[model samples]
Target chain A: METKIRQLSSNLDPRYFQIVVLSALLLYGVAILDFGIRWQNAIAIMLTAQFVQLVGTRAVQLPRFDPLSPLITSLSLTLLLRTDDVRLAILAACIAIGSKFVLRVRNKHIFNPANFALVSMMLLSDHAWVSSGQWGSAAIGAFALACLGFIVLTRAKRAETTLAFLGCYAALVFGRALWLGDPLGIPLHQLQNGALLIFAFFMISDPRTTPNTAAGRILFAALVTAVAGTIQFIYFQPNGPILALILCAPLVPVIDSLLKGRNYRWEQPKGVL
Target chain B: MRILATIAAAALTVAISATAQAFCGFYVAKADTSLFNKASQVVLVRDKDRTVITMANDFEGEVEDFAVVIPVPTKIEREQINVGDRAIVQHLDAYTSPRLVEYHDADPCMDYRHFEMSMDSAAPQAAVLEEARKVARSRGVTIEASYTVGEYDILILSANESSGLVSWLQDNDYKLPKGAERVVDSYLKQDMRFFVAKVNLKEQSKLGYQYLRPLQVAYESNKFMLPIRLGTLNADGKQELYVYALTRTGRVETTNYRTVKLPSNVNVPEFVEGEFADFYRAMFDKQVEAENERAVFLEYAWDMAWCDPCAADPLSAQELRELGVFWTGGRGGSKIAPMPAQDVFVTRLHVRYDGEHFPEDLMFQETGDRQNYQGRYVIQHPWKGEPSCDISQYQAQVRERQEQEAQQLANMTGWDIDDIRKKIPFPEGDAPVQEPWWKRIWG
Candidate 1:
């Protein structure tokens, strides 16, 4: 019993918090907010993700088959990816978990699994698209607050990425508003978008894909923010932040190499790295 | 040989009829925007960089005092601007309006088949529903072009500074809104020009049109957006704007704001047929509130060829061209058959916006999501006539369905549950025979 307690407290996994919060958000979106996620798509993603993860685990020859990470990736895919085809949904799940095994340098995945799958499917098919503005201000505000609180509650291990991304993105929005001589309300409204919130808290702050060091992570976050802003304002495109992340994903290894430090590990303490 | 050919012809006819019934439903009443006060309607047609915009004025105010300022992405030439027929827009509205489709039940005892008939819920026969003026250049403000279109004088103005434009408007007695200067300044910085129009009293009298037709302008630019900031500058609380977008693509949605589908295709109490407008308004209000009053709701998204339950007949090619659908390839003002549906897709978007709720101009994108959707409600009227067999089981099931519909109606419109139940006409001995506590306990 003492050994069990020690083991449990010794590795207080953040995945548990993430799972709870993300599930709550999914529930809120489906039941209360009426987000456009089909039940079949959700089930297809959930099963296909685990199946892909199992295949990937065997290929990589890993000792343990951890369902937690794949579950998180599958949930994120379900939340972000919108498609009518069950085949597309299954493909997205495969790409999401499969990327972690295939696309890597020095045992580190280059892209966030969910982000990679989203960008890949979007580039490939017309049916796959992201509803970035599906979350209204009411939900955005609630989501943003909840995400911030989640970060705080978790002690924000490797949270510099999320903080820097949100800060830089907010700055760019306000800066654009100021330059246009538009009202502050515009930037405030833009910043309170739920997609941006999800990107910052869940997708961007994923420990595996971000740079190792805090400084490297911050710099990476700022660059992603700048690219996203240009795509949105200059190119007049939707889902700017999402596409920006994919575009700047290859730079993660570069950032990690330049600011050389230990890589991120799950369920680790703040000072571990 | 003659008998065989005749039999083949009859079979083909039957096949066609069956398919028609499958794909089509009766268009009952329509729930148009006449239910809302101070509603404005706009029809936007965009392909690549070219856009043709039509603004319908339910102005109901003094024609002389009515003036509108819209921002254009590019400079408009005289030939690019024209006054559109208001009847075509009403036709488009009626065609795409949210409708009620009724499906009457047959005797439960007999084998049955279903049929559908569609009609406009509220045929807005009431609506058949623009002008331009001259301008002087000064203070870096250039009146690029000016002309009279129908009953109004139009001006295409490009200003270097917002204050110059604002002063010019004020000088001309345009009565610019209080915060229009800032928005104009922003648009000017973005390299946008102002398309200003005022009632041409002399032209109006000459034309003798008591009502203002829709003002239309075709321009080529990459910005597929609507300038609502200037309109939002008005401090008269939230404004209702309906956008009917006709495109070659699937659907049009706001990039900056959530384009949500309103509560649709739900069963309501049969009596709702009489008060559909009220039901629609309440349901819409509930949805808008639920979304925190910041979403643009999609009322209908359907192909221009046909409607399942048509609120109004689909617009022909001639009518579409009159509404500035230039790509329809029927420019000789000749009528085209409404068969084999047109390439045009229609997306009807409704937004209730205030400055606080909608801070930015609406940015729209054409998505490939061609899945047809509409704000439709249903009333499954139960068979009331005597059945050839016992109808006790049918009556029991009808009571259950009625209760469920009552609950659904209450949830959708936030109406009182008891009130909905009272409105619901349940069969005699309405309550489901719930097993008594004593019986259940013993069992």
Candidate 2:
């Protein structure tokens, strides 16, 4: 198992694999599902994200330019965000890469870059929205998780947050179904959403933004899940996970303060493709 | 050849090229709700927590035997219920229906000027549909309120248990659908109340009405959803439903299910103009199959102020008020006003659902998306008249367009390409690319 892990993580950053997966999904959505993502908007977002990344690199006085992070952020923004205006797409990309440089806690950004941009754009303008149902409930769901599992398994030390979040979220969902006397299919269908899977395996599992200790990460995941369920079932809003991640983001610093564990750096062992 | 564009077509083209209009469609014959057997129509007017729902069923049976028990989010009073005009509902259907548009090949010798044509929906009078119900007081089921609205007796009932509601309904001769007990229990657990309505023969006679009008109820709740599980409980096959949402802010969509836009803006053969209804039905079935029978098809989404072809003149202001456009005015009905300047946005959704395919009820969310859309199928009429100038090039374009239309129709409705071609009157060998026999041997 260790040899297999070494083979997977030896040569590349995991962000590159994420970029590949998200790009393939975006292409699939555009070509097959007709997801209504305008190519002009996509290009504007891509160019603007890299531009912001370059500006951030120079402003922060970093030694080298890192295109992988911006590329990942741009791909994710394209996959999740839906809009007609080219300007909104560019604004969203700028917000995404820009927040990573501005919003920090203990040298760690508070929110996942893509999650921050999605929520900010949704709250700021009516022109931009997230279509959670865009990914649809299909067999592609399991395939998505399988590909996502590579990043989780390769970064075993950080997989706790993702696993805990999915476990707690699934438990609450099934519990609600049982309480409501709903068919099992309902929760199963909810679980199969490609957006939810992406949230579990990618956005929520961002190591830098998570609690440092395993216990703290699990607690944070559970808390976020509960809050998200309230937003969805009680308040009757869409994209509960995206909103919940932001609402719970500030607690990560507090969790690290209390738990006192190792800090994360991408270059340190876990960030391989 | 000197090709002079028609005055109307030229103006329309200039307008289209100038404005980049979000949506355009010609008014044509619509496949109205009446086309589907046992289909139900619902108009949902919502803003914030407030909602007004109008339900109309095409029930073809004895009036005394028609009864329905609906789970409402809150208890409604007598003033909350009203009998609405069926013409308005029919008009809404006409306004948002998938339409057929045709353009005559503008004297091919002259510049072909293609323009849009549209028609208005005429309101139809409400007709009688029947429901069966009786009264038997029970301990667990409490009738909180009772009133007479139009030709129907209305009652608001709150129940403590599903079995209590079921027994109360059965004891009263309501003839509730089999397996409704589970759904009733579920609704009760959610703290929902039941609204029951049945025809009153004496009221029908005194009101001098032959048909049952649509019933409207207004209430305030955070839940923007439709409970359809009960409707599917007794169905032997799939049941068709049409939901027309009128909102002050923007469009409403099914949150739990995928809302897919129906195939639109495609051209078919000119023969489709004659059988537009059949073409729509076949295309709808094809779409339903393609989505694996699990999606809600968005038939139309447009601003209430105006339509491209003005399908039914965007509903008069008074008509809008009657359909439960609460913000049109204070109660919103005084005089007939012009349209496309109003604040209301309408979204029409259609679904063919059964318990097996659609296990959960439809939950809706109103989005601030005011982008306009409509299902429009076009047909380009060929110029049968002889061309006076260098119009041979235009004729070739027409032939190619006609062949493409044949393939499109085949693709949309899954009809055989050969069969579709058989119906199309192609211009000589222009479509099939025929050549002389000598060319096959020597060239």
Candidate 3:
């Protein structure tokens, strides 16, 4: 019995456990809130997309951790779709997820999944993410709280990135609101109604696209947040995150090199060296 | 001379139409008899036919010195003219020496007339008629009557008279064609009304009485607080009322209320169905005899539920929680089913509008002993002497009571009742307040 128990526990991979737990939380959270197999089907599409990526690449190398892709894509899908039509939702989900894998360069996804998917959906159909559930103040508040908790529990894995994002976003929004002579109350209300919380805590902290050094990550995050906020304010498009990320993503290597203060070097085989 | 003037005027009119494509210019003439002298003031006119020339006194010439000059050898063309073409001409003095000038074609007056006429005559009429027909078709009404007067073609369709046909017409891309006028004429030529009654008796002693058919009740106790009803009421019991209530989010509720009075004779109409005729005759005689008794009230209710709160606050995070109101869930550790409270209320009143008060002292009793008491009742007339009760007075009383209740609720809730009231207004008021900040943000 003791041996059997040990074998069973040992068989459970830690990474698999992480995936299962996170997926379950996401699925059940939506289900408890009246979303059911519809959302699950969306997740299934995401998984299938991941498998497609694995197959298409034909290389066993795993991609770097991306914080915002899943959250953004899930939130966007939830907001835009009215019916639980599995096929349509899955189709959207696949496009949203697959875009991240296929449209990447230098080991980092170029665009924010949530931003790209939302903007693409808007341009294609009349679907609008602005009117999605995640845009609800209370729901956004809850998501922010959850993200904060996750960040804390994860030992502030991307604390610098988060800080930079929120700081820059606040500055941009405040400056614009003041310049427009809008009552301060209205912009604050608008801030609470958008995906600001999600972008700050999740999208900006994406490890692959963000810089490695603490200061670099902070600067990168701040720059992206500011640019995104400005674009959203001026153009009134929904792809602010993707635009900001794409603009800043290329800088990750430069920022890394600057922080390291050394030319990148590759290791050679011992005998050859 | 009059005839000559008329002929000149007619020729001028035609020339105006034809020369409408001439280049606009201002004529300048010298003030003195010197031919070489340059004119000071100028006249500005369109190059097109019938150019509206504005003369400026700044010209140095007296009226006579400014002999109306025209290019003496001007060439006019009748070729199919395109938009932008110029006229080439030569002018000569009495000395017969020619000078050349160029005049570009200007927009034609007939083009403007054509556009205006199209807008006024065909475009608007077609658009308005098409839209009206579309709306009528949507409402399942057949266009059975039509009349044309001048530029207007009025169409009458089979429709529920009291429904918002005019507003619907205006809202749904419907507009009066330009030049077509609408008139209000008394066109409806029918009076269809009916009344049904029932009664109960206790061992030959008269007990109670009730009026049937024209029943007034709440239809949709949510969203829009409006009262509705079936058709008019007469003594005949063959009339039926169809009631429909819809939410802003597209949820619909439908109910059919029907009543029938029986025939006094054994013989039935040849056109009537046998089952219906027999049922009507038996029901009528039985109801008459039972008029010396009491009355009964029956109510039936059903609901159609939609999972989406699209009609409510679309941007609300509570959309997720809204499903809890319809599905089974746990609340405070106890299992519960979804039960959304009716937020909009609709009442369909089928009572008499003929200025008569119903008897208040009447009691209710069943018509038959069956589980479903399908019968009628009759009672003593309440307003025996008073021929009519003023409808306006009753309306005023109801309005006063509603205002009082609203005021009371406002006081209790400590909410801005006035603000809430602004969001929804009575028919007499202007449009409803737009969705608020939170609603717009979330939605």
Give the Å shift of residue A163 in candidate 1: 0.4
Query: Residue-wise lDDT of candidate 1 within B1-443, one digit each (tens)?
Result: 00000000000001011110000000111122011123467789988788998876544445665555667767778777778766666667667777777778873332212213222222111111122344565577777777676776677787889888877765664554456678878888878887666677877776667776677788988788887776555434666677889998678888779899988889989889878777887888898998788899998899988877766667777677767787887544333344334889999998888778899889898876788998778888888886899987788679878888988998999998877777777887444333254643554
Question: How much TM-score does chain B earn in each model?
Answer: 0.82, 0.82, 0.15
Q: Ten-residue segment with the worst summed lDDT in candidate 3 chain A?
A: A264-273
The 10 consecutive residues of candidate 2 chain B with the worst lDDT sum are: B19-28
Q: Number of the top candidate by DockQ? A: 1
Mark the regions of model 3 whose C-alpha exceeds 4 Å error after superposition.
A1-37, A40-44, A53-88, A91-104, A112-135, A139-156, A254-273, B1-443
Native interface contacts retained, candidate 3: 0.00
lDDT of 1 by residue, A174-265 (tens): 88888888999999888878877887888888878888777888999999999998888877778888999999989988988887755555
lDDT of 1 at B142: 74
Quote the lDDT for A16 in model 2.
66
What is candidate 3's lDDT per residue for A1-273, written digit by digit as tens?
999974564454323333443454455445443322354655655665555455544543556544334544565455434333345455566666666767776665655554555556544543222222223334344464445434332332445677667667767767765654333543454455334554554456555566656677777877787778766544433446556776776677777777875322211111210
DockQ-sorted candidate list, best first: 1, 2, 3
lDDT of 2 by residue, B36-145 (tens): 12356778999888998887654444555545566787667667777887667766776776766666776433222222322223332233333343344775877766
Candidate 3 DockQ category?
incorrect
Please give the TM-score that candidate 3 achieves against the real structure.
0.33
Q: What class would a CAPRI assessor give candidate 2's docking?
A: acceptable
Q: For model 1, what is the error of residue A267's alpha carbon versus the real structure, in angstroms, after optimal superposition?
A: 8.4
Candidate 3, position B335, lDDT = 14
